[model samples]
Target: MIEALAGPQAGGVDDLTASDLLALARDRKAAEDRAAADLLVVAARWADLHPPESIHDAAAFAVPGCEHEEPIAGQGAPLVAEFCLAELGAVLGVSTTAAKKLVGHALELRHRLPRLWGQVQAGRVPAWRARSVAEVTIHTSPTLTVEAAAFVDAQVAAVAGRVGPAQLDRLVAETIKRFHLADVDPTQDPEDGYLHVDPRHATIHSDDVHYAGTMRLEAELDIADALDLDRALAHGAETLKALGSDASLGVRRSAALGDLARTQTALDLHTQGATGIRDADGLPAAREVVLHAHFDATLDGLTTVFGPTGRMEEGQRLVLLDQLRSWCGDSRTRVTIKPVIDLNADLSTPAYEVPDRIREQVILRDRTCVFPWCTRPARGCDIDHVDEYDHHADAEGRPQPGPTRTSNLAALCRFHHRLKTHTAWRYQMTEPGTFEWTSPHGHHYRRDRHGTTAVDQAEPPCPPDIPRPRRP
Candidate 1:
């Protein structure tokens, strides 16, 4: 079955019978399981090679007070060196944060959850399924002990790792109760007198996935608070209707939330005015939102009719011009249009410090970190000079080796910035908003506004009669 799906003479997938298709799927799944198991082994070995003892000399470059080993697994697991995650992420085409989680799961499985690990090795359980269990155990609130993790491994292995998230949660909760792993003391704490775990939260998931100019919101609130919010939303929706809004109840409620926020800001401003409280700019503190939108030049006249799309940098989502207009049309909303910064034109400074204008341009040009597969927003990143700036050049009266200019600057998250500065990773800006990176292992990748691409290292062979260019 595997042979039929490989190489030049492989049969077309459309020609396969239904049974053959099923067989092919099974084969692919089995291969994936094997690959996942191999990845875990490799991750464990990588952790072993870059232990805390090995990174002592590199402590100068590490974040202060973060040079210690991180115990990512349960008891008896080896502590992994913190600095080794970034290179692994680059090699795996993932972010450093993801690579760290992978290493944590690998160590948790190998050292603490032996039963599930054995099942994974024997191909009886898929690596992802086992890793899911490991993730829960390793990240338990109080941190699961070795015995508790072993108990989870045995339970999961008995079912061949076919556990659902809810089931896994139940299992973990059971283990926590049976093993007395709760972090809070019931007798000592008045709020947790009944030993009940507090699980209240309100989460606004604005990053990552957004669809149709909307973001998902989730909350687990107390019954009274939930009822109160519902009543407020209902009242706000009614108010919008009274104000001649013809939208549906759902849409009106959503708009009502926005109005509520604006109203609160207004109230705060009024209070600040009464109390003589002002911001650094000598004005009452007000709510402000910075939105970056890119629109096509051709759509300037057709915006009303065609409702052209705009890229909202805040959430990195496409917003229709109509939606943008609706946001700005609110009576309480004030729209301020700032002068546009030309991304193509280079802006420079004489000193090493990056001016606010140059920094804003860099952020706008590169919406995220320039590192391959890094999604850290550029606004929060550090502006790094592609070429090291010579601070002493002016004092010594020599030409500037590196200028503080837009062309020479790129935003990098702290981790990748540190990696580029301290490790063997190197990158150069080929053009505005485009970066070419070469990893320590000689792997090359290109990152631009369009996204990341692996650059082939092999040079095209010259014709038999043609001469190859010689290096200087």
Candidate 2:
């Protein structure tokens, strides 16, 4: 076979047949690949158990052994790709995200059809097909057993041919729900060993600046479940008052305790007003001031940011707000200075839609989707003006086109953001309804009235140093 398919580059066969040599090489490579993939699969399972920080640290250690100090030059995507393409997993392995899918399927199957797992491992059915049955069974009925597993598998296979392991697993779970029955309750008296607690929390923001402070209230135990909620609230209020100091009550507590206090405070206010209010401050006046700040800052900040107007300044304000919230505890009393980006509408340019009439007209022209492959109606798109009506790019590439116009805007959903930014897919609207796309391999694919056409051949092989598509 090797001799028959040998190219001019192939050397003349020696004593051994060329086919034998080729076969040997193929087997060796396959074995190596499988070994590598297996190791990666095991590694992925181990990594799931450990912290990502530890995995990162191990990656840092491996870097010293490489010719270059970095395995993937500190890049995340490439590193992930490398791991995925490891010998065993390159053809059969999955990404971390994909692996998580398997884990999720396993958990679903376990919860729905405990007996079906053994059926799957025994090869009676594939993993995904089994999962699907499990999903159907659980949804239809509840208790699953080995007897029901066979029926579930056959029913799922008939509906959906040979499902992937993950899908099969889900099907099995669903099927179990549909056919399995729960066990009957025992005739003997049942013991109640578990405790149920429902906690509530509330923060009182003093309306008056002088008296306002952040006072958290919480109930320690569930009064409804215990039939003593009022007692619990009273006890919590007393504890809070006792804990409060003149300057401020300093409650050095764990996050759990803080949460409990806040919840109890809410219950106190709801059941019996003012029962859970805690003033950590030594003076009630300071507590009032804190409460005032909280109300003014939280409520005022929300109004100032959202109530104002259109999308023009909303994005800018939101960005600044995000940064402010991160750095400052609250937006009260803190002064914020933001460098202005040009958002003024330009009247002269064709792309500029001052009154948004031009915008609607543009949208009408492109009636459907802006993306080359997408045909979704344009009604939901954000009218991004094309011309630099709002943004003025400086010489340093600061100001540029704002997202409006027939030519500049392509209707995109939130999911397509990264698809446009990172993927090989590229699109351009040449005319009102016409579009073009260039694939990652440089294939110019165009769709028109006649049909789709591939205008080019395969792209040249990329160098090792040059990154390739993460996946086909």
Which residue runs does candidate 1 get wrong by more than 4 Å?
7-11, 56-71, 183-197, 207-211, 264-287, 297-306, 457-472
TM-score of each: 0.84, 0.30
Please give the distance, in angstroms, between residue 53's alpha carbon in candidate 2 and its true position after superposition: 16
Q: Residue 227's C-alpha lDDT in candidate 1? A: 94
* lDDT, model 2, position 417: 32
lDDT of 2 by residue, 1-472 (tens): 4535344445533544676777857766555545533433354343334333323324434432211211211112112222221211111223323443333344334433444544454444455554454444433334345456555535554544355544554554444344534433345232211111112334343222211112344334344744564445445455756666232223323222433433443443454544333344321111112110111223334334323221112111122334334335522223444332222222234334433554444444444344433334444555533222444454456545554444565444433333343434466655544556554445555544332355556466334344433321
On a 0 to 1 TM-score scale, where does candidate 1 land against the true structure? Answer: 0.84
Instruction: For each candidate in the order shown, give its overall lDDT on alpha carbons.
Output: 0.78, 0.39
Q: Highest TM-score: which candidate?
A: 1
Model 1 gets an lDDT of 0.78
Q: Stretches of candidate 2 above 4 Å error?
A: 1-151, 154-174, 178-355, 383-392, 395-404, 447-458, 461-472
